[model samples]
Each structure stands twice: as C-alpha cells, then as structure tokens.
Target: MNKLQVEAIEHGTVIDHIPAGMGVRILKFFQLTTNGERITVGLNLRSGENGTKDLIKVENTTFTKEQADQLALFASSATINQIANFEVISKYHVELPEAIDEVLACPNSNCITNHQPAKTRFYVKQSDQAPKLKCQYCEKSFNVELFSELN
Candidate 1:
C-alpha cells in the first residue's frame, strides 16, 4: 500500500493528536489566519491510539506556554512538536494548568469577571475522561465546551 505524507516544516510547531474536526478551532484560537503564517491542517486522519485525529502545522511559529494551555481546553490530547532546521528539536504533550487566568471567558454573564475589565479566572478540576472548570468569581462550574463561546 502507498502512504501519504505532509510536507515537513523547517522551523515551527506541529500540533498532533487533536481531536478529529478540531483543526479549525485550533486555528481560530491561535488567530493564525490574520497573521499570514503558512498553516496546514489535516482532519480526521487515521490514528492508532485515537482511532481518528487532527493535525496542524504552523510554519515559522512556535506556541507559547499560555497558548498551549489554552489549546488544552479544547484539544487535551494534543502534543506540541518543535521543529528547527528540519529537525525535531523538542516534543511534549500539552498540559492544562491547575488554574488559568484570562485564557478563557466565564460563561456566566453575571460573573464579575465578565461585567468588568477583570480577567476571567478558573480553577481546573482534573478528570481522567473530561475536565471541568469552576469560575473563581461566580463560582460557576462549566465544561471545556464553553471555550467555543469565549468572547
């Protein structure tokens, strides 16, 4: 059988293991379209571990810790691969922080953080299957899906 391959990048980041169909969301989260970075997205690709997964390659860009953490809200299983000079320099799984500030918007409209200039803060509740978040200001509990509603 023949195999397909994505062109490798010289220097940038490769995000692998994203949940299938989430490549566009990741791109939106990073605001890559407006920035003019060369981006390639593969969706619903075969994965031995996940059955199906998505991948994103951003040329000439590296993700920051905060950005990676934000990505975890949606693509928890994603891994970051740093490439330099056509070589894999580093690779690591994205880790969600115990608490994230301003990375997510509180879904509750009455929450103080949403009404004012205050940054939204959340205390992450860990889980093996799915994580939940509790708003620090309103004491509201929500799932990561709220990320799609972020302002």
Candidate 2:
C-alpha cells in the first residue's frame, strides 16, 4: 500500500483543517488568488472518521495576523502553518477577532454603511452555533454567514 503526499512548499503558509465547504469561500474572501502566488488547494479531503476538510498551501507568501483572525469567521478550526526551508516554523489556530472593520458589509440593507461612505464595522459575539456580527451602523446582529464584501 502506498500513501500519497502533497508537495511541501519551501517557504509560505499552509492553512489546514478548513471546513469542507468553506475553503473556496475563504480563498475568495481573502483574495488569495489575486497576487499571482502559487496556491495549492485541497478540498473535501479526509479528516477524522466520516469527516472531511480542506487545505490550502500558498507558496512564497504569508498571511498577516489580521488575515488569520479574519479566517476564523470562515473556519474556526483552521490551523496556520508557516513553513521555511521546508520545515514548519510556527503553527497556530486562527482566533476570532474582537471587531472587524472595513472587511464585511452590514447585512441590513437600510444600514448607514450601505448608503453613506463609511467603513463597515462589526462587533463579534459568539453563539452556540455560529458567531454573530453586530453592525456598528444599524445596530443589527446577524450571523457571520450573512456578511459579504463591503463593495
């Protein structure tokens, strides 16, 4: 029997354990493909028994702490591995940010952010099933999934 392996990056970041359906969303949400960097994506990979996960490897590029924190909205269980010289230099789980600004639009159509020129902001509130984001403008709370790009 032989096991397959993904080629390791010489230096970059690997995001692992993303929820199966969220990988593509994360990639687009973070604009990971816009920089012309080599990105290897594995979707619906085997995880634990009867479970699936997604993994992404970005070659020669690294994410900032802010980006990592934002990833928590998409995949809270995701882990970031920083590799250098084909070795992992650091590994950590993404943390939910206290407040997200200028990243997500308020779900409320009547929100001030929708009409006026303003930076969207959301205060994070954790729930049993998913995180809630409260709009700074409309004061309405919505599940994280309701958010999209401000533009």
Candidate 3:
C-alpha cells in the first residue's frame, strides 16, 4: 500500500462504496463544492470486495435522512458511518426508498415535480438491474440515468 490516504477525521459522516463516477454527483447533492469543513474525497480507491470504490468524508456535517436517501438512489451499495474521535460510533447501509423526494426535479415539463414552487419527489420504482423511477405526485416515470445534478 502507498499509505498515501489521509488520516481520518475526528467527527463527521463518511460515505463509502460510492460508484466510480457518482462521488462528485453526491458531493454536489450535499453542495460540497467549497467549504471550511475538512471534507475529504477519494475516488477510484481500492476496495477489497469490489476491487474499486469511492469515498466521501464530510467533517462536522450532519447528514439528514433525506440527503442520505438521495445518494442511496445511486450508491445503493454504499455505507454511511458516523465517526467521533476517529472511531465509528455507528453505521448504516443506505437503503434507497421505493420513492425518492426533492433529490431531483423531473425533466418532464408537465410533471408536477417540475414546478418551481413544488416539492420534487419520485417513486424509485427500481434500484437494481436497471434503475427507474416514477413521479409520486404527477404519475410521470423516467430513467434515473436521466436525472442528474446541474453543473
């Protein structure tokens, strides 16, 4: 091992097992573009199990269930851990819901979730073997592959 990896944070949330290309997307979801917190992002890491992985370590950021659920939609196999004093206080395996909310704004022009004043929510429909979704409020369905964070 190169031992180039950074040291762990004293306290915060760690998102591990993100898919190779989705770490930055998740970071954007958390609005982690720039901040004073000691956020560490490591991608294409070696995973004993998966052979490759990605990780996000956010220092002092209290992740809400809603936020976690958003990432879970893509990183369903990810692991969320609460750390304190460089020790894991607790751990959670992200379980993407059958429906996701606010994490996305439906691209369908007529979908109710697309209204600026509306709360964007969608039914996950499927998360494995070809992810898909359907709007909870407007009954619109689309490919999760089409839902992406704006740059």
Candidate 4:
C-alpha cells in the first residue's frame, strides 16, 4: 500500500501519535480556525505501536504549557515536536497536570462551579483508556466526554 505524506512544516509544532480520529477535537480544544494559521491534519494514519493515529502540524504556532496539558486529556501519548528551519529542535511528550482549573466545566448544573462565580477545578485521574476527572466543587467524577463541555 502506498502511503500519503503530509508536507513537512518549515517551522512550528508537529503533534503526532494522537488518538485516531481525535484531530478535530484537538483543533477545537485550541479553538483554531482554518483561516488564521497554516494547519495540516492527517487522520487514521498507520502507526507501529498504535494501530492507527492522527497527526497535526501547525505552522508558525507552538503550544503553551497549559494548552499542552489540556491536550493530555485526550492525546496522552502524543508527542510535540518543535521544528525550526525544517529541522526538529526539540521533542517531548504531553504531560497531564495534577489539577486543572477553569479549563473544563463541571457537567452538573447544580454544582457550585457552575452556579457560582468560581472557576471549576478538577483533580485529574490518569488512565490509559480515558482521563477521569473529579470535580473539586461537587465531587462528581466524569470522563473526557464531560470535560469537552468546557465553558
């Protein structure tokens, strides 16, 4: 089988090994639109370890620590590569933070974080299949799907 290759970005960040079909979710997490930056996405790409994966290249854009940490909710095994002048300058894996505040909203409507003027805080529970989040305000445990309902 022939493999399609995505053009190498001159400078920016390449996120590889994303969970298959989750590229769009990552883009949404970043709130990135196609109009502003040069972005490339490859979905369901073959991987040696993982059966298939997704790849995203953002030209002239680099992710912040908070952004990278947020990505760990989905793309835990993903690698971020810094490319400069078409050469990789650095490579690192996304690390999930112990806690994230205000990034994700608690799904419980009656939760204090949702009703009051307080930022939602979550204690991240790491797992290979999915990240489990416990709302600090309501003590409600939910999965990544609930986390996507960020406010």
1 or 2, greater by lDDT: 2
Cα lDDT tens digits for candidate 3, 27-140: 765567566787899989877865778899999876776667667766888998888888898888887776666657777877755555777767777734646888777787
Q: Candidate 2 on 9-78: residue-level lDDT in tens?
A: 9999999999999999988878889889999999998898999999999999988888788899889999
Q: What are the candidates' C-alpha RMSDs?
A: 2.5, 2.0, 2.9, 2.6
> What digit string (tens of lDDT, one per residue) describes model 4 on residues 29-67?
666554488889998988986599999999998878777
Q: Report the alpha-carbon TM-score of model 3 versus the true structure.
A: 0.80
Error of 2 at 92 (Å): 0.5
lDDT of 4: 0.83
Cα displacement (angstroms), candidate 2, residue 62, comes to 1.6
Ranking by lDDT: 2, 4, 1, 3
Of 1 and 4, the candidate ahead on lDDT is 4
Identify the superior model by TM-score, candidate 3 or candidate 4. 4
lDDT of 1: 0.82
| Per-residue lDDT of candidate 1, residues 98-117 (tens digit) | 88877578878788876788
Query: Where does the lowest 10-residue lDDT sum fall in candidate 3?
Result: 142-151
Tell how far residue 86 is off in model 3, in angstroms.
Answer: 1.9
For lDDT, the strongest prediction is: 2
Q: What TM-score quantifies how close candidate 4 is to the native fold? A: 0.84
